[model samples]
Structure formats: structure tokens, C-alpha cells
Target: FSPIQRVNYKIEETRVGRLTNYDKLILEVWTDGTMTPKEATVSAAKTLVSYFNQIVSPKKVEKKEVKEEADVIGPMGKLSVEEIGLPTRVANALVKAGYETVEELAKAKKEDLVKVRNLGEKSIKIITVALVEKGVKFGE
Candidate 1:
């Protein structure tokens, strides 16, 4: 994301400026002709997108060795929530809701966790991120 690509303009002199993407070819925006900020932004963005789309560029993809799923340990069903280093409150809530292990937590849905006491959106996000790092996902 370039600072030049996105920006908010204020009151300035009505003039023309050139923006270049690649090949050193200049794209001149006739902002003086544009009435509003919306018009200028839309005109500039459309010009860039259309110009780039028209350019033909071929990209090559390289095949890499695929890792077998069997190599990953997968979910830890026998491990407790505390063992996974979850927050005390979140772990307590999961335990109270009958989700003791990582496997149980992975099986739970977003709706089910919302019903659990003391667990909110933030807690769910943390739990989901941790589980994802362990190759465990909830709600299939």
C-alpha cells in the first residue's frame, strides 16, 4: 500500500498531476475538470485499474513439495484448556461449559460459545486464534 495510491486532498490549486505505476509511463489526472473529491478519486482509481488491467503480464508459478497432513500432530484432545495457556477467565468459562480439552473447544460453534458465561467476542477471537495455530478449527 503506497501513500501515493491512497490519500485525502484538501483545498489546493486546480491543476494537473502525473501518476506513474510502471514503465515510467505517466498518467495525468485532470483534477481541474473534476467538480468534487469523489469525482477526482473515482477518476484516478478507475484510470489506474483500467490501465493496469489492459497491460499483459504473464506470471509463472513454481510447484513446491506438499507436506503430508500426517506430519502434523493436529488437535490435542487430551490437553486441558489451562495447558494451552488460555486466559484464566476464558479457561474457567470453557471448563464450566463442559469444554475441557482443545478438541472439545475445536468442536464448538460460534453460537455455542456465545451462550457460554463470561465469554464474549474478544474471548472467542483469542480462543479461535490459539486453536487455529494448533491446526484446530471450530464449527467445521
Candidate 2:
């Protein structure tokens, strides 16, 4: 299977309810001839008002401008993981253990991988070689 040529995704609230949180997400994938396929996944929605109705303390939603400007730079979220060509599980383990970005992966030592579960000898060797090819070295 090939990777997606282009895609966009967003998360939204689905339903207004109490004591439950639901999420709705929209994903759009692009194909040839300028064609775009869109899909929406919905989850059960919950609102702070519903919590207040049930006499539970409701959390506040602070107002903030979240819109992206026309000239936003750099990738977001899991895109970095894809660019590095590492397994998702490995990338997540690295990130969770305080590895922020690809540059950090180069300088990661053996002990770092040891700290992550399931990153035994074989996995460490594979990752190390891959990083070396990318000119990433431990303590570099």
C-alpha cells in the first residue's frame, strides 16, 4: 500500500451531553484529477453544561484563536514520525521518554532505548543503523 499523497484532518465536538465526552473528526484525502474524498467519524458528545446539570463542577473553556494563517510552516503531529521512517510504536516510545524531534533521535544513547519497553537488542540495532545512515549519532 502507498502512503497518502495529501490529506487533512480535524477534530470537532459531536453531541451535547452530560457526563460523557464525544469527538467528531473529519478526514479528507486527495487523489488524482483534483478529486478529494472526505469522511467524518463521530463519537458520543458531552458538554460542560451537561455536567453542570448533573451538579458536577464544569471545566471552563478558554477562548483562544486557533485558526491557521495562510503561510503556516512545518509539519504537525505525527507527520514528523512519518518523515523519520520509524515504526509508530518506536517513535511514540521515544517521544514519551523525552525525545522531542528527529534531531534528538541522533544523539540518543543505548540506555535511552533500554528505558523503553520492547526495545531490546534487535530493535536497538535496527534503530541505531537507521539513525547512522541519516547522519544522526549518539551524543553528536
Candidate 3:
């Protein structure tokens, strides 16, 4: 059977020709360098054919996903926020301050962070620095 996706391969040595399915003949195949139209030698071609047979398998259907009424976009929806390794304290602080997104945090000012419960000058400075390092601006 023909490959559904043409495998990109380079021949590293010389090869030969052989008969394939549908009684069609495969000829001089390049073994040492790259893919070529020329048929390979009989033995080399047989070896390549065998290798190809062993490596390639018929495609199979993976587990089916149940259709849903809603659609999610991008990698963000696939993984939970916890999977992204945000610190619990930081997340809690953000949630308490009503800042649930990176954009919101980036746009926050020093005074805004100070207004949040349990937050102080040191925490604000640290958060500001971290946000700036991530290319987010607070006072800009």
C-alpha cells in the first residue's frame, strides 16, 4: 500500500529493485543518501522493502472524543492552571485581589497590589519584578 504521508527519508547506501503489491516493480532505490526514482539492486531493494514493511503499519483510529455543545480554543483549555505550575500563594493572592489573568496582573499598579489583603511592600515589589521579567508592565 502507498504511504498516506510520504515519509521523508535519505538513503545511506546503494539498493536494488523488487516486485511490490499490484504486481508493480520497484527499481533501483538509493540506500546510502536520499530518496530517488532509480530502482535499487535486487538484494538491496529487498532489504529496504523489508525494512519499510516492518516500520510502516496501517493507521488505526484513536479513542473517540464525545461531541460537546461548546468548543475550547488552543492549548490553554486543554490543561488546568495548576498544570502550568503557578505558585499557590501567588494564585491565592491574585484571586483575592480579583486579578485572575496574567494580563490583569501585568496591568496592575503598586497601589493596586497594596490594596489587596495580606499583601505588603515587599510582596508588591517581588510581584512587580516578576511581572516585568515576563514582559508585563505595571506603571508604563
Ranking by lDDT: 1, 2, 3
lDDT of 1 at 3: 22
Distance from true position, residue 23, model 3, in Å?
Answer: 84
lDDT of each: 0.71, 0.57, 0.54
Clashes of 3: 22
1 or 3, which is superior by lDDT?
Answer: 1
Tens-place lDDT digits, model 3, residues 1-91: 2212232444344334552333333333334433233333444468888888866964476987964311322223243322334567766
lDDT of 3: 0.54
- RMSD per prediction, one decimal? 15.5, 22.9, 13.9
lDDT per residue (tens digit) for residues 1-140 in model 1:
22233344344334345743324333333334325545766766899888787675535568877754323336476678888878999999999999988777776789999999999999998898887777665655
Following a full C-alpha superposition, what root-mean-square deviation does model 1 have from the true structure? 15.5
Total clashing pairs for each candidate: 0, 1, 22
Query: Which stretches of candidate 2 lie above 4 Å from their native place?
Result: 1-82
